[model samples]
Target: MRTDWLGAEFDGVKLRLWVDGALSQRIVAGSPEQVLQTMLADLPVTDRPLLRSGWPDAALTPVPSAVAVAADQGRMPGLSQAAPADLMRHQPGRIRGFLTTRPDFDGVLCLIGHSTVWAHLSAGEVVSFRSFISAELFSMIRSFDALPAPADPADDGFAQALNHAMSRPAGLAADLAGLRAQVTLGQSDKAQAASRLAGLLIGAELAAARPYWLGQEVVVIGDGQWDAHYLAALASQGLSAAQADGVEMARAGLQDLWQMMQAKG
Candidate 1:
């Protein structure tokens, strides 16, 4: 079927996904109707129904028909409105499990399906980043977008790290453990360790996206804490970085970071 976004403007972080809608639907088509309804039990309520979010009252756009078609992952045309007591926890395309912000921002964010502008923040800067293009991530529970989710925020920060770590090699895990230990000990080399960790994690996720990055054949390193500490760690090491080119950013590990950030579930 032809597809559309139901055009709505959400001004925040920007992330991207190339949904193979046909593939997704082919997979979902075989599931029983009750199972599909059960999985998407808590679809979020918004001013916009077509648009679902994990953030509170945030505007949302529904997953394009193409995605529903391709992923075959939702109730699609047969979805029913959720009752107040439904235990189901989200719409298929709804993003984020939590939506939060410091005291100053006007709108709250949802933190489910994908990464958003909020992620690029340094607990300080509110810059717009196109990568993982999202308006924000919220911890709002009881459904924010189409997905009905726990109002309690999900620990996405940790989820992204741990999820990626699980797929990588034991060697890389060992390396990260050692590095983190040194970091906890207040080692002077934490800056360098973090820098290297960043690259390794980036490498691992990117490699995973390749058709050949079989789970048994590859090793990944790093969790995203390094990025959280990036600027401070760089200063600690006395390194002045320059503007990151998109290609280099992807090559330098943003690509893998992208993969991890885009992870499902």
Candidate 2:
């Protein structure tokens, strides 16, 4: 009955690890395939080691002697490749529904991560969800130019740009062009431009996803600066979100599945 979990997050650039229920290591280099292979090769053999991910592809990555489980499937009692969407329907006692109210918004639960956002809404007898690609947009912004060293989050430029985008989501593309123009004209420093670009892109996502967050309780997950930026954006709009450690949440989720499997015996 010994159960151990290996939870990993692959946020395009970095691969982070959590062993048991705590963070054990981080690998900054190598592609997702390479880093995962190297990390799994180094771990001590365990009969009950399970691997899970916040995103789908990470869980699909092959691991030696470890079973991979999709994020949503990890909450179930048995191993299955059921798509997350297929499990969205409410099942009465099997799948309970609840609402979360943030300071300024009220809706069902929303989990915002580094590259993606998941919002789940459960009515009395039906459930629905939506996903957004926020992180990928930010990454695209970073690829445009190398950001100046030591980008400070405290820069007012970032907040202003975020607010601007949130208020005028339709003008996001034009705003992006404006950032580049500012850099070219020496009107803004590279550091400030980078921060502002991030804010604008994330703000656009927030605007598009207003239905999920407009008046709902939100929980921000994942590691690094991107996650922090998300929380900051929500706060700027008078919305307060609870922060959860992504690593621990993944580990605990896997453990819950293991227990359910054991109880089914």
Candidate 3:
């Protein structure tokens, strides 16, 4: 309710990226957790729980006791019952959680967020419940947006979405040309140029290309420390989890950079 700053509904997804101290003010808004649950409902084939850590070593506050296991677990900003999801990792304000049925919960994959960690749920440890993400540093990761509908495997529209998704790299190539020119012209700071270049790659590779990411999981490689940090922060939240490796990130970014190089030749 209070922490309402930049609220722009873009491309069918409501995005709120904050700046300054407004990060602390309370937000009377919808739950990102719920949007994800509804998204998962449409993805029955996602029969496995994707577990991972969020940033800042976030914590969780599981649902109340005396509440039936089937009862909705109240968590997140709305403090309502989450969609029958179970906690894979539990800290005071954050959790790695999800739900799986139809296959008798076939396997427990490694839950990952900022990074992946192995978990051992003790007997009656009460790991299953509604949960919320709480972090001192990243306390403002309350991003709530809708995951796009799964593209129909048999539909042409699916192919178009993939095309739209793939064109992101092309867009980045175009943007990079202008930015690199600015760098040469001494019209832009090195840091700013780098940031812009990296953002293009991420927008094209991570967010836009997401619809066609092969594994239902995306490995976000960054070219520089800033990009790595960006991916790490997103990973910390329940967004697309990413891994950080200097060499790998360079390859992802440079692959696009090389396209520019080839064009020049």
Please give each candidate's TM-score.
Answer: 0.25, 0.69, 0.24
Ranked by lDDT, top first: 2, 3, 1
Query: Residues 95-174, candidate 1, lDDT per residue (tens digit)?
Result: 11111112232221211122311112222222221122111221221023222221111223323433454356345557
lDDT of each: 0.26, 0.54, 0.30
How well is each residue in 210-240 modelled by candidate 3, as lDDT tens digits? 3333243433322232334334334433456
Off by over 4 Å in 3: 1-169, 212-265
Q: Which stretches of candidate 1 lie over 4 Å from their true place?
A: 1-50, 53-65, 68-168, 184-189, 212-265
Ranking by TM-score: 2, 1, 3
- Ten residues in a row with the worst lDDT in model 1? 17-26
- 31-76 in candidate 2: lDDT tens per residue? 6546766777866635544443433332222111112222344322
Query: How well does model 1 score by local distance difference test?
Result: 0.26
State the displacement of the C-alpha of residue 110, model 1, in Å, after optimal TM-score superposition: 20
lDDT of 2 at 263: 69
Clashing pairs in 2: 100-217, 105-215, 105-216, 106-215, 106-216, 107-215, 107-216
